[model samples]
Target: MFTRIASALLVAGLLATSAPAAHAQTTAAKKAAATKAAAAKTAAAKKAAATKAAAAKAAAAKTAAANAAAAKAAAATPVAPKPAPVPLTESLASAGIKDALNKGIVKAVQFASEPDGFNMNDDIHIPFPEDAILMKTTLSKFPGMNTLISTFETQLNRAAEAAAPKAKDIFLNALANISITDAISLVTSGSTDAATQFLRKNTEAQLITAFRPDISAAIDQVGAGKAYAKMTSQYNRIPLMTPVQTDLTAYTTQKAVDGLFILLANEESKIRKNPAARTTDILKQVFGR
Candidate 1:
């Protein structure tokens, strides 16, 4: 009976020790499972964050590429140049006046410089001096006096025609020296011959002074002086006739200058009124308006 009781005590001790060991193993297994599950969840979250970051980076790259492409295209496009500004009205008017007047002067000079320019054209015909008209009338009654008067008048016209070309340079010089302070006013003036009138008012005295020598030379070349001397000699021989002393050079110069101005005025009128007369680009630009 004592052996049986000791055996039962030993078995009971053995079972009690095994039961505690089993309980400890079960708790260890549960802790390992929870740790594994937590690690997997963290890994999954990290993977999802990595994927989202990659997508965002890719989208940003795409947006940047698109912006770069747009910028490159903009750089490749050609831009148009800006147009030139229009000239001022006053400047245009002034230039137009100068060009028109120059052209008109050239035309007038060319026409008057031609043969029979003054004699054929009654507008510019040179006759015997007005101051000596009574001398002509008194001499006309004498035999061969009519022939002398006619010859003298023809020679006077020849002198003027010969002298016409020399006046062109003087005129051009005067034109070059002229100051057009009121160019706009002159252009807007309603008169067709306004430019010519202006030129005459400014340059007439200069023209006469410069042209008298040329007129005297032309008169001598064309035998106008000798013809005048002959006419005067006959007239001076008349009894009780008032002695007439007229400056042939001065008279012829004045008449010649007057003729040139008349022609110049006509040319200016044509330019102002006729569209076809605006031959140059500047002329068309100004007067075409």
Candidate 2:
């Protein structure tokens, strides 16, 4: 009976030790499982973030391609054409005439007002007046008459050059006041001096009235009166020479007008025949055809 009791005690001791060890192993297994589960969850979140980033990169590339295509399409589109110029009309012709005249008048005045303008130009130089030619011929017999004649001629040209500046305002005023009843007729007149002739015909009286006082003043300023007085006094002193009288103011005025018309005619011809001579936009528009 004693042997049996000892054996039972030993077995109970062994069972108690094994029970504690088993409990320790179970706790260790649970801790390992939880650590593995946490690691798996972290890896899954990282993969999901990577997928989202790749999707965003692809979407950005697609948007960029779309924008490029749109830009290229816009660049290939064509633009609209400009409108044509207006057709020929009477009002257009009138406008053309005014523009052409303004250009011609300004240029002609500029040419005539410069140094040696009338004096150097053989085409329009003022010679001795018709009545004064006989007097000049008679005076030539006297000593130093050639020098006096030359001085007189030079004074006449200087007077014209001085008076040319006055024509600007006068011509502009005439341009403003002159009538163009049949502008087409003037345009189609086929004559180079058609416009210039029109101006002379209508504005001659006005020009004479305006130019006389200016010419008179210029004559006095250029010492032409002194020269004329010397010539007349000397001529009158000649034995039995008839005293010749001529209106210097009227003569100068008429000659100046004649010279201006010649210049105007030449200018108008250039505008009509030569495309390059139309220097201004209005001139080009009017005379381009």
Candidate 3:
């Protein structure tokens, strides 16, 4: 019986020791499984982060490329040049008219103030009185009467030449008095001699009044009155011919004024037609085209 009890105790002790060892082994296996699961989770997270970073980098690169392409396209496109500023009609008109008038008057004055200005120009050459045709017809029949007539004609031309220099101040004064609206009208008018016509219309009476004194002085200086008297006396001596009287000052002054206007008109027309005649910046701005 003692031997049997000892065997039982030994077997029980062995079983208890085996049960504890099995429990410890089970705990170690559970801990190793948990560690493996944690390692898999960490690997998955790292892979996901790498994928997101690569996608973000690729997207950023794509955006940069698109921007570069857009920039290149902009560089390749051609840009239009800016247009020139246009001038105002009113400004153009004033400038053009002033320039044209200045040009015309200057040229007219130059021609008229020179030697044979009125005497040589056929267009303006002062002829003997139209009313004195009968006197001329009767006088030419006589011998020395023709010479005296020629002398009278020459003196008439001489008086005109002497008086032409005074025209510049008169013309400038008329220009100064011109209204802005009037200047614009003259420039915009299609007529080539519009400015000249304006001057003729406005300045004729004034010029006639102003020029008479100078013309009268010129007539005396050139002895035009005495020459005209001699011719009239010779004609009056003929019994069959009616006696003739001429207003030498009046005739010469009228002819000179007419001649000045004719020359001015011609010069104005040239300025309108010829680009070379546009001497000023304002002239070119309005009429250059």
The estimated TM-scores of all candidates read 0.67, 0.67, 0.68
Task: Give one digit per residue, the lDDT tens place, for model 2 in 26-70.
Answer: 999999999999999999999999999999999999999999999
lDDT of 3 by residue, 201-279 (tens): 8898988888899899988888878877777887788788767876778888999999999999998888778988777
Candidate 1 lDDT tens digits, 1-289 = 9999999999999999999899999999999999999999999999999999999999999999999999999989987786554453777778888888887788888887788888889899898799899998988888988987887788888888877787777677666644556677767789988888888988889889878998899889988799889888878888999878999999999998999999998987887888898888787776665
**Model 3 compared with the native: what TM-score?**
0.68
Alpha-carbon RMSD, each predicted model = 27.5, 18.7, 26.6
Q: Which residue segments of model 1 deviate by more than 4 Å?
A: 1-88, 178-180
Colliding pairs, model 1: none
- The residue-level lDDT of candidate 1 at 273 comes to 83
List ranges where model 2 is wrong by over 4 Å.
1-86, 178-180
Better of 1 and 2 by lDDT: 1
> What is the lDDT, from 0 to 100, of the residue 114 in candidate 2?
88
lDDT of 2 at 107: 87
Q: Between prediction 1 and prediction 3, which has the larger lDDT?
A: 1
Among all candidates shown, the one with the greatest TM-score: 3
TM-score of candidate 1 on Cα atoms, chains taken together: 0.67
